[model samples]
Target: MDTRALSVFLSVAETLNFSRSSELLHMSVSAVSRTIQRLEEELGQSLLERDNRRVRLTGAGQEFRTYARHSLDEWQRLRRKLGSDEELAGEVSLYCSVTATYSVLAPILETFRATHPAVEINMHTGDQADGIARVLEGRDDIAVSGRPSQLPQRLRFLPLLESPLVFCAPSADCAVREMVQTVDVSRADFDWKLVPFIVPERGVTKDMLDTWFNNRGVRPRIYAQVAGHEAIVAMVSLGLGVGIAPRLVIEASGMADSISVIAAPRDLGPLTVGLCSLGQRLASPPVKSLWDVAEQTYPRAI
Candidate 1:
């Protein structure tokens, strides 16, 4: 089987758009279509379901995606092993939020690139909450993520820094801000149930927020359940509702000036931010090298 064809298939399988895949792979749309057609013909399977509206992966496509990833990893390993004893050279796929690219990964990537110039870093940015899932699914070799309460047995986490999970309100004069001002939030008797709250839809931050509210015996008035801390901050800045996010993310968000931190009666313990990867992936030189560089970059105890 041609590895190039597998690469093209994986690209299309991920983006689910021929035009986007072609742009990423630097191939023409027709060429990309032909490549997928050849792969389907060879395997006698319909890998993708395409219509004018959108493209979606078939069950076979999902399974083939997993297989293609492993095959590529093995092929890269073989090539490296057979090559001359030079610096490590291959691609390492990484996943993180847009903020993490500069706030968390900048220093580490700077150092890694300096040491391993030949290695390529393919980074994908999305909601920080999805980082762990992406790494576990083998969609990315590593991800910058908050440490989950229960670490998966197959994964390893390297603690880098800690950021307090903070509640924030809009700085602008709005109903939400007025409500916060009318009541002393630091008092134990404050009516949290009356305030509209923007919260994470899922992930560690959401879990922490749930525990915090439950422990306080207050069922929060949830206004919105959204993905990504950045979105939460943006909404809060517009005076939509009060929200919770890591202090690091709030500081990094350009709209920080528009958001005000709320002082709660009790603190939700700081969130530990770190690098996460499958234990097996760390065995790969490129992935391991980046992991090591990150550890050295943030050599502080969590």
Candidate 2:
């Protein structure tokens, strides 16, 4: 069977839409259908159940999808292994937030490119909160993420840098800012409940924030839960509510003048920012190379 057909099948299987898969594969819808038809004919089983309403994978198709992924992975591994030692070449898919793309990944990418010029870096930038989920879902090979409170057994983390998670409020005289200023930050009896809190929509940052609030017995008056720290900073700058974000994000944000860091209690720990990927994926040459370069670029903080 042609590997191109397998690739097309995988794309269609993932989207469950023939038109979308055709667009992704740069093939006409009829051509895409014919390729799948040929594949199914050779395999002697119906792989997909399609009708006007929807498209779905049959049990055979589901099993074939897994096989296709493994086959493609193995083929890429073999190609990389056979490449010239002086010029390593393959594709490496990476996911990271916009801030990280510029702030953290830029330097690492520069170094990696210098070392492995032939390796294609297929990078996707999105909300930092979704980095881990994207990696777990096999959308990407690696992701830049914060160390979650409970690290999963199937994943491996390589610590890069430490950035303290800090509370932020509008520099302007807003309700939360006024309330924050009224009470001494050094005092233990400060009424944290009065302050409205903005937080990440989901992910480790939210997990950390939840833990911090629960530990203090403070039922925070949440104002908003946004997808990214950049949005949180934007909201906080507008005096919508106080928010929590890593210090790295705050520094990278151009709105430093519009927002002020709250003197959060010492218990709010710093985020251990780093590279992470599935333990199984690290065996791939391109993935392992990037992982090693990142480790060398930013050795684990003592």
Candidate 3:
């Protein structure tokens, strides 16, 4: 019945850490635990399970998480509807990578804020790999992400920019460059497998690399599989290996002095980076307003 408790429960459910939830809520760990206990007692259901090692949601907890998200969204929607006539007002949680936060998200957020001054923008920045999952989990209203080969049916993507997916090599002499230069195999004999690659550990970047290599009938020799495009830049800058990342990431990395874009194979094409959100989320006023601004500001650069 207590919306505050429900909010606390959702935070804990998302993080799966009592201490983290407490910190996020600006409450003591004991307070967070008590709030969850009270909610569970009210519902007559065991919502979560905890051990010394970690915490996890029980089956009931998963069901309640969905309920809590909708309940909070509806509550906020009602408040906005009743509270304001001249201005639309509500919180919009957005997620993006560090690069996107400055590059793609900056202008979009600025425009959104100017239009809806009463609305709060709760922005979370992290690796691009986690962007869509954040939206799908109901944690973020929207996220900046690259369009995947097969987008989920529940989600919608609006293209913001097109950046070529290019292979990057160390600007200085490196083993990867040396190998590429020395391995003068004929077009028929060219073995991409001979070159070492530093690639993203997950997400569309990894998927793209997998597809590119598979289509070419060669498995790249991975020197490292890292989490972020920035990390790829760092690794490639050190001559650790060649890497593939969007031109946007490279341009924003500030490490362009240390890396150079390699001529990516023709099969590997440009990436379309943009905003992503659940179709359901767009129905919310704050989310819809921001989505409108995004559509108007960046009209499908692809």
Q: Give lDDT per model, in order.
A: 0.88, 0.83, 0.84
lDDT by residue (tens digit), candidate 3, 173-254: 8667787655443243577678778889999878887986676687667888889899999999988887888888889999
- The Cα error of candidate 2 at residue 209, in Å, is 1.5
Please rank every candidate by TM-score, starting with the best.
Answer: 1, 3, 2
TM-score of each: 0.89, 0.84, 0.87
- Full-model lDDT, candidate 1: 0.88
Highest lDDT: give the candidate number: 1
TM-score of 2: 0.84
Candidate 1 segments exceeding 4 Å error: 83-87, 264-267
Winner by TM-score: 1
lDDT of 2 by residue, 99-124 (tens): 89888888789999999898878677
Ten residues in sequence with the least summed lDDT for candidate 3: 180-189
Between candidates 2 and 3, the one scoring higher on TM-score is: 3
Clashing pairs in 1: none
